[model samples]
Target: MVGQWSGREARALREAKRMSIREFAAHLGVHERLVSKWEAGGDRVHPRPVNQAALDTCLARSDDIERTRFAALAAPEPDSGPRPDAGRSAAPGGYSNDAELLALIDTGAARGEGLAAISEKDLIMAAAHEASEHAGRAEGTNIGPSTLDQLDADITRIANDYVHTPPMPMMVEMLRVRRRVYRLLEGHQRPSDTSHLYLLAGSLSGLLANASTDLGYLDAAGEQIRASWAYAEISGHNGLRAWARGMHALIEYWSERPHRALQLAQNGLQYADSATAAVRLHNIEARIWSKIGSTADTERAIHAAADASSAAAADSLHDEVGGVFGFSDAKASYYAGATYIHLGLAEPALAATERTIELYRTGPARQRSYGAESLARVDSAAAHLINGSLDGAEAALLPVLALDEDKRIAQLEERLTGVRRRICAPAFRGVAEARALDERIEEFCGSTATRSLPPGSG
Candidate 1:
C-alpha cells in the first residue's frame, strides 16, 4: 500500500476521514501543495519514501480497529459520564484555536453526530466572548441593520459577478465584510438587530466558503462552511439554512461524494417551500443520481426540480445569491447535459446542450453567466465529438475558446481538458480535423494555466 497508492486512494482516505488537503498535510507535517499534487496526479505520481512512510502510517491509524470501530458497538453499552474536561470548541465563533477545533471535529466524527448536536446555552456566549476578544482587530466602523442589509446586497453582487471578477479581489472584499460583521456581533445591540447580524455573518461565510473552494483550498472551504452552518443555526433563517445545506451538498459532490450529496440535498428540501433553493437542491440530487447511473432516481430528481422551478416562478421567489444558490435556464440545461453524459445517453446530452446554447444566445447579455455558458459549450462540443461530428464540435466550442482569460474558471478548464482527452482517442488521433482541434485545445489550455492565479488564493 505504500508505493502503490494512487490519487483515488489518497483522495478517498482523506475524504473518508472528512479531512481536507490542508488538514491532512498538517497531519503528515508536509506542505499542503504537495498533498494536492499527489491527489491531482492520480495513479501517475508516487510519493518519496518519507511521505510513503507517513501515508502508510496515516492509513494504518485511519483504520486502527479501536479508532474506527462500528458505531453499533456502543449500542448496548452503558452511558459513560462526561470526561474531566470537554473538548475545545470547533465552532468558528467559539473556538480559540484551529488545532483544538479540528481535533474536536475529528473526535466528534468518531462518535455519532459529534459536536454538531451540542446546543448548550453557553456556546453562543462563548462565541460572543471570542468575538469580543478579537474586536480589537476589527476596523472602527459603526454598523446597524442598514449596514447588514447592504452587506446582503454586496454578497449578492459578488455571487453574481463571481464568474467574471478576479477571485483575489472578490475574496478580499468578502473577508473584509465578514470581519466587520463579526465585530458588530461583539458589540451590544437589540435582539432583533443581533439576529440580522447573524444572518449577514452566515451568508458571508457561505460566500467565502464558495470562493475558497474555487481557489482549491478545501480545508479553508470546510472551515467557512462550518461557520456558515453555525451562523445559520443561530439566526434561525429558513432560507439561509436551505442555502447552506445546498452549498454543503454541492461541495461534497465536487469532492466525489455523490451519495452523500444526494442525502444533503434531500435534507435541504425540508426548509425549501416554493423557494428557488428547492430547485437548486433538486438539481444537485439529479446530478448525483446521474453520476450513480440511476435512471429512475435521476428522472425523479429532474421532475422534482422542474416542479420546484415552476412553483418558485409562480411565487416570485428568485434566489438573491446568484452563484450557487440559483439555477438559470442555461444552468439547468447544462446540468441535464452533464447527467445525460454520465448516463451514456449521447443524444440526450447533445439535445440538452443545444438548449443551453440557445438560452445563452437569446438571453440578455447581462444575464449570461460566462461560467455556465462555457461549461455548456464544452458539453456540446464533447457530445459532437462523441457522435463523430468533428466540424460541429469545433463550431460549438469556438465561442467558448474565444472567451477572455478573466472569464474562464477552474470548472471550465476541467471540462475543456476532458474534451481534449475524448478527442485524442485512437480513432481520431491521426485525423486532420482531430489534429487541428487538439492544437487549438493545447494553446487554449496553456494560456489558461499561465493566467491562472496561484492555488489557495482565497
Candidate 2:
C-alpha cells in the first residue's frame, strides 16, 4: 500500500470506494466500455479526472492523491537546446549578443576614445558573438525586464556614438543590428518585450533620418522619418514620434513649404505634451510661424516653449533630457531670436541672440563657435543698420561674408541679403560699402536678385 501503484493497484483503488465500472463511468461522464478498457489494463490507463476523483474518494484519508494528480497532469519539460556554460554560448538558433558589444562602444565613446581601431565588419562580428552568448544564458531562464532594459540602453548608446563619429559606418552597423534584433525578438512572447524592440527601431530610424539630412539627402531623410514615425506609433512612444514630426517640419520649413511646415508643427505639438518634447515642438512651431511672417503666432509659440522649458527644468532633478531629441535653453533662445528677426523686432532679436551666444559659450566648443560667430555677425549688422551706421554694418558683415558659405546657418545667409538691400538709404550716401556688401552676398548666395522676404509687411 505504501509503494507506487501499478495498473492493478490503480484499478483496485478505483473500485474500493464502492464505485462499480458503470457507476464510475457515469461519474466520469464516459461509456462503461471505455472505463473497463482503462481498469482492465488492456492498455495502461493514464489517470483521467474520473479515475483521479475515484482514487481520491477511496484514499480520502491518504496524503498522496494531490502528488499523484499533479504528476499525471504535469507537462513535459521543454528542451533548453543549449546551456550558458557549454562550449557553445549561443542558442540552437544562432542568436547574437549585440547589446553587450554596443555597451563597450558606448563606454569608449563616453571616455572620448575611438572604437579601439576596430573595423565595422569586426565590430559587428563581436556584437553577434555577444548576442549569441546572451541568448544562451536566456534559454532556460526567463528573460527579465531589467535585462531587456539594459539591452535597449546599450543599443541607444552605441547608435548615438556611431552617429556622432562616423555616420556612414553607423548606418551600416544599424542595418545589421536591426536585422539581428528583429530575429531575436521574433521569439519573444510578451507585449512589453516587443515594445522595447519597437523603441529601438524608432531610434535607429530617427538617427538614419538625421544622417541623411546632414548629407543633404532630403528624399532619404523623409523616408527615414516616415519609418521612424511608424515605429514610434507601434511603440506607443508619444514624445519620440512628436520629435520626429518636428524634424520633418524643419525639413519642410527649409524647403520653403511654410504652410505645410505649420501643419506639421501643429501635429507635432499635439503629441508633444510632455515637458521636453513640448518645448521642442513649440520651438518648431515658432519657426514655422516666423517663416509665414505670422508675428502673433510666433510670439505665442515662443512664450509657450519658454514656459514648457521652465516647467521641464523644475521637474527634472538632473539637467539631462532623454531620447535623441536635442533641445536646450540655448536652442530655444536661438529660435526665439530667429523668430524676432523675421518679425523685424530687432532689439528683442539682438537680446535673444546675445543670450544664445552666452549659453553656447559655456557649452560644446563646436556649437559655441557656430552660434557665437553667426550671432555676432547678425547682431553687429542689425545694430549698425538700426543706428544708421551703414559703413559699420558693412564692416561687420564683411567678416561674416568672408567665411565659407555654411548651409547649416542658412538663416544667416538670408539675413545678410536683407541687410544689403535695406541698407541703401541716402543718409548712408556712401553707397560703395553697401553696394560691396550686396555684391558679396549675391556672390555667396549665387543669385543676382535678393531672396524674397517672408510674406506680408516685409
Candidate 3:
C-alpha cells in the first residue's frame, strides 16, 4: 500500500486518470496552476488538508482499472527504503488513509516545528494549522491588495492623461495594462478580485475604443467597445455599462449612423447611475439629434444634460476616475457648440463655442483637452464664416492652424475641412481673405495624425 502521498503520488493519480493538468484541476475544483505546482514539487510538497480531502474523494471515484494503474504508478522503487518518518504513528483525523498524507510541512519550519525534539503529532498539528491558513489564502485570491491598488491607481492616471496625451502612446500603455488585467483574470482569484479586474479591463477597452475611433479605425473601435460592454456586464458596474454604451454611440455617430447613435445614447441612459453619466448620455443624444436635423429633440437633449449636471454626485468611474471617463462642463459646452453648428444657428454656435473655449482655458490644467479645444475653435470659425465675417473666422482659426501635426486628430481635420468647404462655397468663392484661409486649412489637414499613419494602418 502507498503509505503517504505527496506531489509524486498526486501526479500518478492524474496520470492514472489519463487527465491533462487542466482536466485534473477541473475535476478536483482547483486551479490548473496549483496542480502544476503540486506535480513540479514532486515528493517535497504536500497539498493542504482540504485539497488532500478533495484528492481522496477524487481517487475514490476512480474505477477499479484506474485504481490499479494508480497503485502501480504510485508505488515506491524496489531499492528505496522506508521514508524517514515511516515509524511514526498514523496521522489522526482524515489523514489516516491508505494513499495520501498532507500537512503544512512546506511552511512549518519557520514556526519552530522543525526542531529535533518536536513530537510527530505536534508537527502534524502545526502543519494542519498552517495548511488551513494556506487554504484560506489560496481560495480567497491570487492577487494581493497592493497589486489591485496599483492597478486602480494606474487606471485613474491613464484616464486623466488621455485628455492631454497623444492617442498612439496612450493606446500602447492601455494595451499593456489590459494585458496585465487579462493575465490576472486567467489565474484563480476571489469573486471580488475578479469583479475589480473586469472593471479595470472594461475601462482600458473603452479607452482603446476611443483611440481606435480617433485613428479612423471604426471596425476596430467597434470591436473594442463591444469587448468593453462585455466586461462591464461581467463586472456588474453600472458606470462602466453607461460609459461603454456612450462609447458605442460615439463610434456609430462618427460612422454616419445618426439614428443608431441616438438609440444607443438613449439606451445608455438606463444604465446611468450618476450625474456625469446621465449628462454624457444626454449630450451624446443631443449631438445625434442635431446630426439628424431634429432641432426640437436636440434642444430637449441639451436641456436634459443641463438638468442632469445640476444634480452632480460622486461616481466611481466618472468623478472618482476623472479623465476620458469624465464629462466636464467644457466638454458639454463643446458638444452644444457642435450641435449648434450642425443646426446652422450661427449666433448660438458662436456663443456656445466661445463659452467652450473659455471653460477649457480657465479649467484645471489636467482637464484641458487640446483636441476638443481645437474642434471648438473650428466650430467658432464655421459660425463666423456663416455670418459672412472673414476677419472673425480667421481670428477664430488661429490656434487650430498652429497645432502640431501629431496633435491633429481626425475630428480636428474633419472640422477644419468643413470650414474649408464653407469658404469654397459660392458666397465666398471670390473673396481673397476666404481663399487664403481655405489654403491654410488645406495645409493643416494634409499633415494630420490619420494622414501620417503608416500606409493602410488606419
Candidate 4:
C-alpha cells in the first residue's frame, strides 16, 4: 500500500508526533539540520532506508489520516511525485555558528607549518573581525537616550498586555524583545544607562518566566527566573530584586520545594519595605505557610500582607511593568482564596472567591484578568463541592467549561482537576448529575480545541 512522499508528508509526520525538530532528530539519530533539509526537499527527499523502516514502525500506531499517509510514504518503493531540486536551491548555512567555521579552518590549517602559514585562515579571521566591527557600529545606533525611552515604553506595553493574552504567543515576543535589548547592551552607553537596560531585561525575563510557567514548562521557567535574578542583581534595583526573588519562590513552590520557596520569600522580604514587592512577598509567604498546613504562620503572613498593602499605597512607588508584579484587592483576594483552599478552609475560601469575582467584575476594566477569574471560578466550584452542594458546584463551573478552547490555560485545567476529584466522592457517586458532569468534562478534555495551538505557539 505504498503512497506518495513529499516535504508536506514529512512535516505532517513530524507534527503528528508533536515533536520539536531537535526532538525528532534525537528520535531518529539524525541531525536537526538534516531533518530541515529533508522537509525542504519535499518529494525528492526521504529518510535513508533504515531510518524509513524506523519511521514506519514508530508511526504506524497513529490513527490520524496524515500519519497514515506518512506510514504509506515510509513503505518500501514509495512513489515520490515530481521531485524538486530543493537541496541544490537551499542556501548554505549562515555564519552564526562561529565554532563550526573555526573548526573547519583549524582542520584546513593542520599542515606542516603548524597553523602559522595558512593564508586562508588569516583572511577569514580578518573578515570575521571586520564583520563584528560593522555589527557593533550598527548596534551603536540603538544606544541613544531616546532609543532607551522607546525600549522602556515597548516593554511596559508588552507587560501590560500580558494578563489579557495567551502566554505561549507572548513568550516569543518577549524573547524577541529580550534579544534586541541584549544587542543594545553591546553598544556604548553610560553606566547608568547600562544599568537601566539591565533592569528592563530583568523585567522581560520575569514576564517570560511567568509565561513559561503558564505553558506548563516549569523547569524552563525556573531557568528564566535564574537569569532574571542575575539581571536584577546587576541592576541593583531593590524593587526588581524583590520581584525576581518572589518569582523564584513561586517556581520553587510549584515545583514542590516548599522549604526553598519559603527561603526565597524571606530573601525577598528583606527588600520589601515601602514597595509593592512588599505586598507580593508577603502574599507569597502566606501561600507557602498554607502549603505546609501552618494555620498560625498563614495567619501571621496574611496580616503582614495587609499591612504591606497599606504601606505600599502610601509610598507611591509601583511596578513599572504589569502582569506578575502588581498587587491589588482583586489579586490579593484571589491569592487568599487559593491559600484558603490549600488550608482546607472551605468557608473562607468561598468567601474570598466571591470577593474576587465581585471585584474583578466591578473594578477597573484594565484590572480584569480573565485567566485569574477562571481559576477563581474553579475554586468557588470546589468550595461548593466541599459543602456537598453538587448543583451549585456544577453551576459555578459552567462558564469555565464554556470558555473558548484557546482561552483555557494550564492553571485553569489544573483547577478543574480538583473539581473532578470532588465529583467522584462517595456522596456523589450515585448522583446522575455527577456522571453527566464527568462526561461533559471528559468530552471537553478530549477535544482537538485543547490540542490544536495557533501558529507560532512555540
Candidate 5:
C-alpha cells in the first residue's frame, strides 16, 4: 500500500511500471544522469518542463499500479491475469498526484526551506515568462480599463511585498514586468484613454521611485517622482497628484532643500480638498513647515493632519481615487510623533514614538523590523537630549552615525546634528569622544547638504 509517495516512492512507482531509468530518460528526451539524480535524491527536482513531464508519466504508471493492487484485493482467484480495471485511476481526483506535488512544494516554502530546494524561483520565472508572452500576443491592441486596474493592483502588491523583504535576484526581472505593463499603456493612443493610462503610469512611477529610494539611488527617485507627478496631473487624479507632489516634497526635504520642500508641500495642498487625501497632504505640509522653522504653520498643519486622520478613522466619505492611500490610527500616531519631535516637544514625541513602536511590534514582524530599529535609536537620542543627558544622547546616536549616508534619512541626520550642537558646550568638557562624534556628524551633513537638489525645480 503506497500511503504517500516521497521522491523515493515516485522512483519506485516508475520502476514498478517496468520503466528503466534510462528508458524513462530517453522517453522524456533527457540524459540518463538526470533521471538517476532525480531517483537517488542527489538533487531535489523542481517541477520544470522535463521534471513535470516525468512526473506525469510516473503518475500514470502509479495509477496502473494502484488499479492492479485494488483488483488483486477484489479477486477470489489468485492466478487471475492482469485485471481490466487495473490502472483505471491510480490517484483519486488527481489530488494525490499534481495537487499533492504542489502542496508539498508549498509546505516546504511555509517551513522556511530555501527556494533552491523547491525551485520556487523557476516557478516565478516561468509565470513571468507566460505573462510576457500573453502581453506580446495582445500587443498593438487596447486592453480595457479594468484590465489595467487589475495590473496596477498586482504590480503594487509585488512592489509593497518586496520592499521589506531581502532584495531578490529576480528584482530586475520583476521590474521588467512593470516596464512591460507601462509600455502597454503607452501604446494606447486614444485621448479618452488618457486617464487610465496616466493612472497606471503614476502607479508604476511610484513603485520605481520607491525601489530607487531603497537602493540609495536618490537621483533616480527624484526623476521617477517627477514622472509620477506629471502622470497624476494628466489623469485629473488630483488626490494622486497631491500624493505625488508630497513624494516630491519628501525628496526635497531629504536632499536638504527646505525651501523647495515647503513649496512642493504647499502645491500638494492645492489638491488636498478631497476628504480622503487630506490627511496625507497635511502630513506633508507639517513636515515641510518643520524644515522651514515655521512654528505657526507647522502647528496648524499638525492640527489639520490630526483632524483629517480622525476623519479617516471615522470611515468618512473617500474620493474616487483608485489606489491605496492614507493611514490607520497607529500610522497616524507615528507621523504625529515625528511632527512633535520636529516641534521640539520632546516628551510628547517620545510618548508617541513609544505608542507607534508598540503598535507596529504587535502587528507584523516585517513592519516591526523596517524602521523600528532606527526609530528606537532616534527616540532615545531625542529623549536624552531633552533631559540634558548628553552622554546618553551620544551613546544612543553613535551607532547610527556609522551607517551609510542615506539621503532618504536626512531627517534622522538632522536630528542627530541638533543633539550634537545642543551638547557641544559643557557636556563635552573637551572630551575627544564628543569632539569626534560632532566632527563626524558635521562631515556627513556637509556632504549631504552639498548634494541637495537645486531650488525652483519643484
Candidate 6:
C-alpha cells in the first residue's frame, strides 16, 4: 500500500495516471501551485491533511493496471522472485521448514522421549541446539538491507526538508518515521543493525526536539532532546551527540537559561568532530554569551566559530544528513547578527545580516531556508532601528512582513516583538510611521506558525 503518500508517491501516482501537474491538480481539486510544490518536495514533503485525503481517494479509485504502474514507478527494484527453498518438501532425514522441524521434535516426544530419561547436560545442549537452529534458519534481522537503505534515505530527506517544509507537516512525517523506527527496534536484529537504527532514531528525536522548541513547548523539547542524547550514546555516534547537545542548548537559551545553555554548548564542543558541528556549537556558545552580556566571551566564541568553519570536514550528522543539523555560512552569519543585536552592536549586526541574506540568496537553491532568511531580515531591521533609520528599518522588514503566516515561526515572532519594542522607544514615540509598522508587526505576530499548529501536535 502506498500509505500516507509523500510527494514522491503523489508524483508517481500522477505519472501512473498519465496526467500533468495541472491535470493532477484539477483532478485533486487543488491549485496547480500546490502540486508543483509537492513534486518539488519529492519524497520529503507531505501535502496538507485535506490534500492527503484527496490523494488517498484518487489512489483508491485507480484500476489494477494503474496501481501496478504506481507501484513500479514508486519503488523500482530488481525482482528476486522468491526465497530459494520455496515449497520444498522435507527429506527423509531432514526438515524443510520450521514447522517440519517442530514436527520432528514432536515425533521424538511421541516415541516416549521423556525429559526424565535425558541427562540434564544433554537436555541443555539439545535446547541450545534447537534455539540455534531457529536463530539460524534465515537471518535474525526482521528488516533487510534494502529496508535499512530506505530508512536511511528517508532520514536524510526529512533532515533536508525540515528547514523548508512547514513545521506541522514535517512533524507529522517525523512522528510517523519515528514510530517505524521504534517498531523495528522492538524486533531482534544484529548488533550493527541495531546501532544504525539507534542513530536514525536519535536524529529523528533531535529533529522533533527542535520542532517542539519552535512550537514553544520547551518542556517537551527538553524531553525529546534527552531521548536523542540517550539514543546517540547507545549508537556511539559522536556527531549525533554533538547535534543533540546543540539543540538542547538552543532550547535552554530560549527558555532564558543562559548559564545552562552555555554549559550545554561548551560540553557539546568536545563531541563536535566535524567543522559544521564545531561551528554550530561555537555559534550557539556565542549566542549564549551574548545573552549573558559577556561581550568578550561572545567575541571569542564568534572567532572560534570562524576558525572551525575554515577547517571544513565531512560529518555524518551535519554534512551528509544536513537540514536543521547543518550550520552553513549563512546560518552562522545569522547567528552572529542575532548575537550582535543583543550586544547593541548595530553596525556589526547590519553587516552580519547583509552577509547572511546574500549567502542565503546565492547558495544552492535547495539550501535556501526561508525561515532563516526571514529572521535575518528581522535582524537587519533591528540594526536599522538601532541606527535611527526608520526608513531603512521599514525597508528591511518588508520581506518579513510579506511572509506567509504558516512560515512565521515562533522565533520570527519573538524577533519581531523585539523590533516592535525598539520602534516604540522614545526616539520613535509619536511617529506615525513607527506606529503603523508596530501595528503591522503586532498583527503578524498574532497568527504565527506555532499558534496555527493543530491540537496535540506537541
**Position 21, candidate 1: lDDT:** 69
For candidate 3, lDDT tens digit of each residue in 1-458?
A: 34456888898999898766777899999997788667756787799988888889889899999999999989875766866435443433212221223332333432443344345564575467647755765675569869999999999988899888888888889999999999999877888899999999999999999888877788999999999999999999999999999999999999999888888999999999899999999999999999899999998998999898888575799889978999888998898899999999999999999999999999888989998899999999999989988899999999989987777888887788788888888888788888888888888888987788787665
Task: Give the per-residue lDDT digits (tens) of candidate 5, residues 175-197.
Answer: 67667666766554455565766
Clashes of 4: 1
Point out where model 5 deviates above 4 Å. Answer: 1-150, 166-174, 186-194, 214-217, 273-276, 312-326, 366-369, 390-425, 430-458
Winner on TM-score between 2 and 5 is 5
lDDT of 2 by residue, 26-54 (tens): 75566766555544341244556555555
User: Cα lDDT of all candidates, in order?
Assistant: 0.71, 0.60, 0.84, 0.73, 0.58, 0.84
Best by TM-score: 3
List clashing residue pairs in candidate 1: none
lDDT of 3 at 390: 88
Instruction: Give the alpha carbon lDDT tens digit for every residue of 1-458 in model 1.
Output: 44466554565566655555677798889987777666645455677877878877887776655324322321233457643224534353233333223334444542445455444533455456547644643433356547766877877776666655656577888889889888888765666777878888887888888777765566677788878889888988777777788878878877888888788889988977544778777887888898888999999999988887767331212365665456677888988998887776779999998998788789866566666777888888888888888898899899878876655555666678888888888768789988888888877876552256666532
Model 6 misplacement above 4 A: 1-131, 134-138, 454-458
- Backbone collisions counted per model: 0, 5, 1, 1, 2, 0
Ranking by lDDT: 3, 6, 4, 1, 2, 5
Query: TM-score ranking from best to worst?
Result: 3, 6, 4, 1, 5, 2
Kindly list the per-residue Cα lDDT of model 6 for residues 1-458, writing each as its tens digit: 65677877887899898765666899999987777667645566799889988998999999999999998988843467753333433333233333233334545631344433334443355467657755673355788869889988988899888887777789889999999999999776788999999999999999899888777788999999999999999999999999999999999999999899989999999999999999999999999999899999998998998899888676888998888888888898999899999999999999999999999888887888888899999999999999999999999999998887777888888899999989999999999999999999998898888777678744
Candidate 3 vs. true structure, TM-score: 0.75
Q: What's the TM for model 5? A: 0.54
Per-residue lDDT for 219 in model 1?
69
Model 2, residue pairs in steric clash: 96-131, 96-132, 97-130, 97-131, 97-132
